[model samples]
Target: MRILRFRAFTRPGDPTSGNPAGVVLDAESLSDADMLGIAADLGFSETAFLSAIEPDAARVRYFTPRAEIAFCGHATIASGVALAREGAGSTVAFTTNAGVVPVAVSPERATLTAVETSVEPLGGVLLAELLDALRLETTDLDPMLPPAFIRGGNPHPLVPVAAGVLGRLDHDADAVLRLQDRKGWDGTIPVVHRISADRFASRNPFPRGGIREDPATGSAAAGLGAYLRQHGLVTMPAEVTVEQGAETGRPSSILVSIPPEGRIRVTGSAETL
Candidate 1:
């Protein structure tokens, strides 16, 4: 049982700053409980297990320290890069619980295609609760972009805040977890500020998955792409960049591309650690 650790979404020339994920290439022999135990032992936000289903295609499962999630973008990127390093070809199709995520690999980076994404309205009551949980007031939120429940590979309630407020995202872990569960969100994505029409800064608090925060969240990035496109926040055929992990001092970036009509593409670099 060889477990490989890789740092996903690392900044160029800075391997130490990225999101870490565990990859188990030969996971066919491992059961669900075994995967859960391994993820808990590693203590990463998510770990990916791969089982060969066909040539250039594999069945991948994602598990957090506490439970299994439907999808994980960073882990998928890490696994695809791992497979490419092992001669799996330039492209791999991952049959995930959410959907089939196709990843295109290159020597320098990997790009993952997300599932269908949607942006739905956030209820008034839930929005208030979420604001309270994060210790934010309505005035602190971005005036142009109201909060909404964005669903890509997973569920994220994205709240856009004013400038200078995203750096102070501190709250009770238990209370935040409770709020996520109650609102049926996998995590809360508080976008600190929009640097430009094509770039933004964000922080994702994922207490429900037994993690305090994610340095880089690919799924959330994809979700945000969908939100921005749907709301006309950015121009069509948009390519957006999300800056994350700076608050944790592990700065990382995720590139998201939203086409005319299809799954969004999230790209990033990974390094073996």
Candidate 2:
């Protein structure tokens, strides 16, 4: 029943930033209730439970304080580093509820190739509802990156905000929860602003997970990469950096690599806490 904690997506030499996640190395005997209780007690946004299925493969499950999630990027990164530290080798395959994710671990960082990604335009009615919940106006949106439902592992509504509007993102918890329930969304709603061709700032609200916001969201970043590629916003085989958690004072940087065609790669460093 040992629980390990790690801060994922942290910058070099600084462990104070990034998102904290819990990892249970041997979770084969733990029931769903036990995992849920552990996640709730840990109070991290997400925790990963791993059961080794082979020397370099394992079945991983993710849980938040409120419910189980199909996939979690930060927790996966943390688990990868943790497993590597435990002599699991440099590469490990994690079979999550979403799909099989392969991670390449190093002493300094870990890179995870996410499952297949897809993006589709969001309906105007749903977009309006989402804007109302986030206390944002249509004018605040970036005309270039329209609202879309992006899925890397889990699905989230990507709302691209205009410059200077990202810092002012505020959402009603109750309203967001209601929308999430109605829409059957398990992930956060990300409001992003482009800083440059390859850089962006983002804030993700996770009312469905009983969290106000996520400091660094790797899954959302992967989805964003797919969206950018699908919309011809970025050139093929490009790398994008997403800066997040500034509003919460736990600034984190998530790097995503988009290939010409295939799974997106999300890379970050993690430190044990």
Candidate 3:
């Protein structure tokens, strides 16, 4: 089966810094094992396979190098761009494992609307474990933002830390993986600093998905939006910008829109890599 490659959530006009994902447009004949093998072979953080496609919608699946994920934001964005390139349409609904994700694409950018979202308080034990794994003390946390678990398409613990602390975090990979498995979390998203009410810098250690750090995490961003709104941190109907991947040298910009009704919208630019 032929596979297409694209970089999603990239810096405008610079494909070198975005998260690389595989896109398989003609995936109808492939089985679950086949898709997993393809994703593993591609060795990207995640790959998107579209087994069914139509003018207005498509059935899609997402896989990481290690396992199948419920949904992937960057891969979904890449799929939207790929569909547009293949003449699918300007807008399309992707029937995904999480739910129906709607995406809109222009020539230069793509935006995806996440499914229903929510935030839950993290238990003290798990929060302590996570903080210890990252060598962070409770005092290191951002007083205003605190820590909580956010769920957009997947679950992640969003820990808010003081400025300059995010770039300094280093955790044992195996321990992080064990914690993720124990808690069933996709990743631990450490939001390093809040630049402003509308801007923030975040980092994620994704040992469970077999990555040390993700350049741009749309899933986490969506969840972060929900977390912010849930805590009454941001005003209603807000547009927030996230800066990621700078530590990895492939900086990414993710635009998140939180509506008054609570659904989060994530938008980014993509390019073929």
Candidate 4:
């Protein structure tokens, strides 16, 4: 089994943007447990294992250190790029825990159209608990955008905060675990700015998955697009870009599209290392 690690959303070695993803080849031979172990060994926020069901279609699954997630955007971009190198075309689709995600690969970039996404109302008790785990105050949120539960393939509590705080995300790992299990949530991020009136700035804390921070998160960004739409944060219909990882030195970005109807589209580019 071969594993490929790459930078996504933003350039590698550039602080303050992008996602670092692990790509696995010949994953058809590996079992689910084997895949999970591989993710643990790689130590990336997400690792993708490809099991081909068709030449143009494959069953793709994502694994974090802690468990299998429904989908992962960065890994999808990395995989699409790898496949294209092997003669895979620009248009492609991957079956994931989230659903069938369509991907478009360009000469120097790959964009993944996320499965259906939506925003759920936040449960006050659970939100408070997560905030407590991170030692955040309600005032930290951007008064402009209220918090909501954003669901792409995974669920994330969208905490709209100030851009300055995006670089100051800190939290208790144990408490995050407790909150994740207690609230049945997968991950959480405190957001501040929308890159454009449509885009956003965010920092994700994924202690539940054993990740202190996620440099670039496409799935979460996709979810955010839906959450923003639901809350009327962006009354105008538009595609948005998300910038992350700057505070930690691995700058990343995610481009998302939201239509009045249908699933949100998340796009990003990845490079092999």
Best by TM-score: 2
Report the lDDT tens digits of candidate 1 across residue range 54-136. Answer: 55899999999988899998898899888888788778899999999999976457999999999999759888887888878
Candidate 2 vs candidate 3, lDDT winner: 2
* lDDT (Cα atoms) of all candidates against the true structure: 0.86, 0.90, 0.84, 0.76
Candidate 2 has what TM-score? 0.98
Model 1 TM-score relative to the real fold: 0.96
Model 1 misplaced stretches (Cα beyond 4 Å):
none
Better of 2 and 3 by TM-score: 2
Q: What's the lDDT for candidate 4?
A: 0.76
Residues 1-273, model 4: lDDT tens digits: 678887778664554345777888778889878998999998888888887745477788888888888888788888888777767766878988788898887645787888888777664887788678877778776666777778777888877775566566677778877877777776555455654686677778777676777778887888887887777767656778787777767877778888787778777777765
Error of 2 at 265 (Å): 0.4
lDDT of 3 by residue, 129-204 (tens): 8888877888889888778888878888888888778878877778878888887876445555798989999887
lDDT of 2 by residue, 242-270 (tens): 99987877789999999999999999999
lDDT of 2: 0.90
**Per-residue error at 170 for model 3, in Å?**
0.9
Ranking by TM-score: 2, 1, 3, 4
> Once all C-alphas are superposed, what RMSD does model 2 give against the true structure?
1.0
Model 3 clash pairs are: none
